[model samples]
Target: MMIGTLASAMASFARPGVCKAAAAYHGPPASNFNLGRILRYPNLIGCNRSPTKKSSAQLQLWRALTTLTKREGTVNGPAGTRFSTVADGVIAHNDHAASRIAASVARRQLTCTMGRVNYDVVVVGLGAFGSSVLYHLAKAGLKVLGVERYGPVGHSLGSSHGASRIIRMAYFEGLQYGPLLKRSMRLFLELQDELAAVQGPLSEPLFLRTGMLDVGSVFERALCSAQVQGLQHEVLTGAELNRRFPAYRVPEHWRALYQPDGGVLTPERIVQAHVGLAQRMGAQVLTGTTVAAWRVEGTGADAAVTFKLVPTDATAVAASKRMSYSDATATAVPRNVTAAAAVLTPGPWIGQLVPELRELCVPERQVVGWFEIEAAARSHFAPNRFPVFVLEETSGGAAYYGFPEHGQLPGFKIGLYRHLYEQIRNPGDLDRVNRTANAADEAALRSGVLSYFPTAAGRLLTSSTCFFTNTPDGHFLVERHPRYPQVILCSACSGHGFKMSSGIGQLISRMVREGPKDTAAAAATNTLQPPPPLPPSAPSPSAVDRHVVQGLPQMDSDSDGVDWSELLPFRFSPGDRPGHREALDRFS
Candidate 1:
């Protein structure tokens, strides 16, 4: 009888245009499926066994199905329900094919959508990482919503707003990222193919394989990583480097590691692609909407997310005159959104949302300067002629990185890694205006040019400032909130996260769907593990006594076999400690 009532509710929802036509259709009528029907069928509701348990489970299931059907606009066949929808709707679910979902619901362990919870996951911050997470989640048939604090292009202050970010496989950081990096590369290639299918072959390239070069002792680690991960690379002495690319004067002592696989990533395009794919897959993306506050109500299976939202920019609509003043006023009205699970990928603004992590990850203002290249040397720095490079000083000062000429910029884009930073006290008020290239910035970059690429050193053309949300250990913080397991924290990429955004996004999506298991896999592969210090007798990477190569978090990868426990979130005592050090030791 309980199943019969469920079938009746399904039938009632299948009535075409009945609910849409009604000016105010509150819910299904009593004739459809009412509480009285369930009360009458005592035995069917398991009153013969644990009455309360069976009744509660059935009611919850019934309510969940009704809510889902209402959102999906169709009630599928009885037991083998097939949930399907077009762009910007709900996730498609085929219960028969995916038994895990049905079994979860039957076991009463499905906390994703309980009473009143609308979406399975609400992603805050629709930048590169957030957009990717939303796309993957929506593609997996989960009701997902993406909320961004800025416009569709994202705020210029964040790291994901640029036209280009470097992608490399020869990681100098450590070997742990090997597997994840390879996975990301594959996904990126797949994304390109997917885009080609939809937008035609002539569509602008998403990823350009221009190759990459590492000009520092850190290349030793890269060589090690390449060897361990079966990645292809070439070792070049300074003489060989100068012979291959005439753009720069390689010092006799400086050796370099070259990887043909490294290339440039179009960040803005990637974000847009993710957002586009996600929307097409029925994920709702809300741009220019700031998440004012979010809190979890209840706990575990009964938990729900309640968030207050406000417009990130109000004057834009009024200035554009797209709507009347009355409509503009309505746009500013605050909205309350509820979800089963919420992912906070706010990037630099993460600390503001979770105060406990404020100390762990701090946002720093970093600059990228574009310098003009002479017509004579332009051909030398073209995508085919020269590869992207990360050059370091012999005395262990700040490292500098730059890319070959991509179409977006009129000049060669270059910037110092982790240097030239100002602490961002407030994530909202990032100094976007006054961050133009000053004399010091120009002089510093020119000095490097004079020392290395002498011919291409031209005037500073343009510059932009972005934030680097850095952690102390430089590892990513992709774990659950200490207090709220329903709330996941997925940000603080330091200065080297954009390249890994694709893989990180996939891992994050998996976490939302599979819970602990996905999170463990991601954490195991992605969490930072710095290489052990080398002995003095070890041969220097540069083969010169004056030069030194320091390792840092640069690339991302994942391995096949993983010890799930090794990737568990840091344990913490139920106290007011910073990182829950006592409990975090469990993973350590």
Candidate 2:
């Protein structure tokens, strides 16, 4: 009885007008029909079981017969409209084939209707990492959606809005990052080129290759890692550094490791580029929308992540501009979005989205200050003349990093690693935190500038505050949830994650594509023993370094020469505190 009723309903919708429209519509070629994707629509099929290719193709034809029957005026009208031009083209081009398939679909009692849309993957948080993930996934031909709580892709509300972020290959944190950094640099360059080819040449390149200097305690570790990775670097005394750049006033005993590949990446531009390319590749992006909650439904292959979206004021305003208030209200109503998988890269908001990580991935407030350079020394602080540098104070306090004068922003940009040591217990508190430079913040930055480059220090020009989502161990957490494998978590990159955002984005895309099979394989080989103790006088290698050194080459043939095992140390285990005791860490 139910089958007969559904068949009658489908037949009623398949009117002569539908056939006429199907014949007249010019859409994608018949060969481009994706029956598998069409069959994956459980609501349309009225069942979740996978159908054979023959049955899937037949059901797909049925979907077109029913969906295209809607009034011609309703095409592309609302969410309820289900007209698929591609499906119509298939039916129009292969009338006999589609008729036979439609007969089979009727016999099988297959039913389809316009319903809530689903995506192959949904990336929450369109910040640096999430934007990159969205681009890679879309480029791979997956149906993807990127959701950002803020307005647009490069909003200043998040950590990715800064004008300049340091990108260096001579990693002082760990040797394992060398390959990732190299890959990220290559990806960034490729991204710039790709955007240039499409959007035309940019006013300024996405990345600027300003040589970098690493000083203080981590200098030796950086030098060692540089040598191990075969990176081009130079070790110079404080006097040699000052003489070479004429922007330093380090103690004679202090030594620095310099690498020419170190440079600056425009965070805002990079994020926008990734999002723009992703959109060009058919990735849907929702700005001013927040994923209030998410959960996995079903088990195994049938599992799907459903996110409840809540619109912010920005979304409401934009919606109001597009339609009537009633229509906008209806549109703004919270809806559930379903996806095969989800990648969460919400930066400081990671804790709010993934409660399990709330305590582990803590958000800390940080400030960056730009100081005007003296007229006489302005040329010395130019990107070509000065190099990005990280100076570790002799007193073992916070390290200060600075960039040469670049971008429209005036003055030389400099920031302390954990400026003011302000840790936000609640992510919401970030809104209340003062974003402008305070007197203390200015004084601290000025003090560092005076100590290092006295000649360049002039006056406080501008300041901005952003959050650094730090983990207890100060390493990135890039892994699937402990219990929910369908939900991937990529956050808590400590403070220096921007440089590697592109590479991490690619890695997460692979993780989503490989799914549970590769995840299980990684778990089987997760026999990661703790690193051997180092001498008291020697700095301990990071967990990443130990993993890379213990015969697990950072790059392998699998997944196009990216060894997933290299990330084992960063995995979220039950009680494992990664790099907790190893205090030897540095920020970009």
**Candidate 2: stretches off by over 4 Å:** 1-117, 314-334, 523-560, 574-588
List the lowest-lDDT window of 10 residues for candidate 2: 320-329
Model 2 over residues 125-205: C-alpha lDDT tens digits?
888889999987776556678888766567777788668999887787876676667667767887888878876654458
Candidate 1 differs from the real structure by a C-alpha RMSD in angstroms, to one decimal, of 11.1
TM-score of 1: 0.73
- Highest lDDT against the true fold, candidate: 2
User: Each candidate's root-mean-square deviation in Å?
Assistant: 11.1, 10.9
Which pairs of residues clash in candidate 2, taking residues 3 or more apart in a chain or in different chains? none
lDDT of each: 0.61, 0.67
Instruction: Give residue 393's lDDT in candidate 2 (0 to 100).
Output: 76
